[model samples]
Target chain A: MNKHKQVVLDRNKVLSQIQRLAEVAKTDNWQYEYDAQLDELVYGKDFMPRDSFLFNVNGEINLFISPDSSVSGIHIEYFQANYLAHNQELQPALRAITKKTIKNQRDNEAATALEIELSADAFKSLFSKDQLITVL
Target chain B: MPEQEHILKCRDCEGKLVIFHRHNYDIHKKKHPELEDTAFFPDRVRNALKYPTFTIPGNGNSVTCYYVEEFSINGIIKYTKVVLMNKPYIMANEKIHHIMTAHKVGHVQEEKYPGLKKQMYHNGNKI
Candidate 1:
């Protein structure tokens, strides 16, 4: 075979090997942010224990927590609300009320403000993978 | 003790982010009837607040929760962005979320190296 033809064949063979390896790896993922992190910067710690009450879907409290409800060394009872509400269907308002409880705290103000700013940003987050839905 | 301030991290040099993990920090509490009894983790993010010149959906909705953290593991650093969304729950499209995550990581990278995002915006990721 001609030297030029031989070189072309070798290049083709190398390319074929690369293609096979690519299929084996099969991890072509676009880079984005991770999800576990939101809490790190926002809450600035792992989930802690706190005082909380479980409210109902109709906006009524299933049971009220004591005035001094926080228990030390717990996940900080942050908010015992619904995670599925963001999915759809009118949430009992418990989540909103619970969230309201945390809104604008002196310590959280900085984190909340940052989150609010990012929310308005033109760029998207890596963890916004979950499907978004509006409730009636 | 808990968190410091906010800064950026780079995805290229470092890696991905850890995200939303609230650990050791100064704690503050609230006990208002309206606000209820809630706790604060301080400026937990301490390092992810740059990327100024921001904007939200003109459609009229506010964000409730979000945070991104970049750290190293096994000599590889990664970026993570946690979002606890509320209103306007339904996003415009699917790929849009991925774009946003990439953008947030972009924010982390910009935070690490000043002017990176703006430079990328202008130069278009030549690297």
Candidate 2:
């Protein structure tokens, strides 16, 4: 009997394994919600943050910073009419992402009340290089 | 559970303030239950509002008030105890001032509101 067995890689199994890895990587994508009633756009990490306090950023935006000084979330009041309208370049992409997030939340029966998450690609495309630096 | 409320005499507006049982009963509890060691009791909150270090106006006549006590060494502020009124509630109502929630925060830059300090003086000390 041969002491060592020859290992064969199943091509389909390998492809599926790679796809699973890609999905796992998307889990860290940022989540957002445009609350119509509040007229605010809340963008942040998906989980409930440990006790955070609001730090007003230029009166319009509020950054929720944790005790550790990490920025947990961002809340932009009067989002569409004020914030987005003023920044015309950010409007199209933001609106599209918001719509898609809402639709996804409505479709997923198991989705919690937390803000809907953006897909990996959508999250990456949401902000330009400068915008990302400024916002963060 | 029986309803418990705290009737506070707001020093800011010099009016009656009410903290309903439901407002600070659960997560933002007045007294910490056996579950946790943290507490945001009413008395401390009321005291902070009465002698606030700084206040900033919010949208729609609301105010974000803070009662900060600083500890300095050699003219350098090393630590600060910050009691923040988290919600932008109606704090100016002479008839009845209803403040919503209050929480403690970490060190905050006093230079954030430069002009507001002129209006925020307590015990002859410029806040």
The lDDT of each candidate is 0.23, 0.40
Which run of 10 residues does model 1 chain B get worst, by summed lDDT?
B94-103
Cα lDDT tens digits for candidate 2, B49-127: 6555555443222334445443333332211122223342453442334444344432343333354442464752444
Reference-based lDDT, residue A81, model 1: 24
| lDDT score for residue A48 of model 2 | 30
Model 2: residues with Cα > 4 Å off, grouped in runs = A1-42, A45-47, A51-71, A75-101, A104-136, B1-13, B18-44, B62-94, B104-118, B123-127
Residue-level lDDT of model 1, residues A57-102, one tens digit each, is 1111111122232111111111212222232332322333234343
Off by over 4 Å in 1: A1-90, A93-136, B1-46, B50-127
Error of 2 at B127 (Å): 9.8
For model 2, how does the per-residue alpha-carbon lDDT over A101-136 read when each residue is reduced to its tens digit? 546544332222122222222223322222211111
Which candidate number has the best TM-score?
A: 2
True contacts kept of 2: 0.02
